[model samples]
Target: MLYDRIGVGYAHGRRTDPRWLAPIVAALGDARTVLDVGAGTGSYEPLDRTVVAVEPSAEMIRQRPPGAAPVLRAVAEALPVRSGAVDAVLALLTVHHWPDWRLGLAELRRVAPLRVVLAYDTRRHADFWLVREYVPEIARLELSRPSAEQIAEELGADEVVPLPVPWDFADGVFPAHWRRPRAYLDERVRRSCSALAQAPPAAVERGMARLRADLDSGRWEREHADLLAAPEWDAGFRLLVSRR
Candidate 1:
């Protein structure tokens, strides 16, 4: 559906950033079987685990690299998985995309004793330079979605950890280029982010035009010199780990 339309070249831009992998794997604990819900291109699936992926987008499924976990063409709201079939359930940066995230969370709980979710906190994202200065529309778009706190509360999370984006984060998700404004100018990079891809064309074009002008005039660098020197930034990503 949405991904099939916008996820054409997803794999090229959304590779697993090892920085993120460590925490996810650690949160998974001793889980031998993991169900990766909305496993886009299977980016963060653990190689050592018995992982089964669930995705609704054929285009995204097609992009899964060779030797990736077996996938079922299913939506998160109604996972085709048995009750307590897996040791853990991992939903990474995908809950917002679900039509009914509550249902998805319920399914995750039903399928495993442990649930790990990576969610976005719009309040924190509002402070990100890109959203603060250029694309306020992205913040508006995220408002209707459940926040990281809400997800944590719904799942009764045992821990809510902040996930900061490294200066050179390998993944091309939104806010990955907080210090590297030039990356947003690239059409490929913008298209890889769902917010940018789904954002109104007029708004995106207007923001990009302003961002380009700011870069050309060195205003961006001058304003964010401190951020340029910083190693990483909290772009509102949070990891919610729950145990039954």
Candidate 2:
């Protein structure tokens, strides 16, 4: 599994952020049962609901905390549950990793009356400060991601809401610590972000060196000072909701 090799200890950095949960909880909309596809480390599973998780990576499954929902070793393309078996299905930041995302969406639609997906637009991510300034290779990485529009069209989504990342976002997902540039220097933080891990190691080292130099000289702070005052940033994250 991709995560098993590069994603060990992911839970240490990638815990759920409360600010990102309200929208997800609301989208659930009275659903008694939820199927969390690609459920990694059980970060976003609502404690108030009956939740079942489907995950392919054994490493990720092993990382789930003591009281997390039951997880099945399965891929999204072929869920073990029956058609309409759950009230809602949630796929968060995991669709782009699917080997066959369209087929996976069909499986989610087959098993639930409501589907909610958290996705990103590659173009928007390219404009982010980290990618634009430090890692140009991230532009290529973003290009490979399944676009927000593509996912919305596939699911026939009824709502696509913007999900701007908070400056102090607790989740260790990409670009979450936009205001805290130093967080990027931490190995654990980068380990949880696939974009950093996937980039060539030498290129990553070069980017990090440049970033460190910029921070020491106050060049980064000077360039992005406006971001310090902003409460949140739009990094192209979107929530796609579909109800049938």
lDDT of model number 1: 0.91
In the range 1-244, model 1's lDDT, one tens digit per residue, is 9998899888878989999999999999999999999999988899988999999999999999999999999999999988999999999999989999999999999999999999989777666687778888887777878889899998899999888999999999888998899999998898889988988889889999999999999999999999989999988899999996
- Superpose all Cα atoms of candidate 1 onto the true structure and report the RMSD in Å to 1 decimal: 1.0
Candidate 2 to native Cα RMSD, angstroms: 0.9
Model 1 is weakest, by summed lDDT over 10 consecutive residues, at 122-131
lDDT of 2 by residue, 7-53 (tens): 88799899888878888889899999999999999888999999999
Name the weakest run of 10 consecutive residues (lDDT summed) in model 2: 122-131
Query: Any runs in candidate 2 off by more than 4 Å, and if so which?
Result: none
How high is each candidate's TM-score? 0.97, 0.98
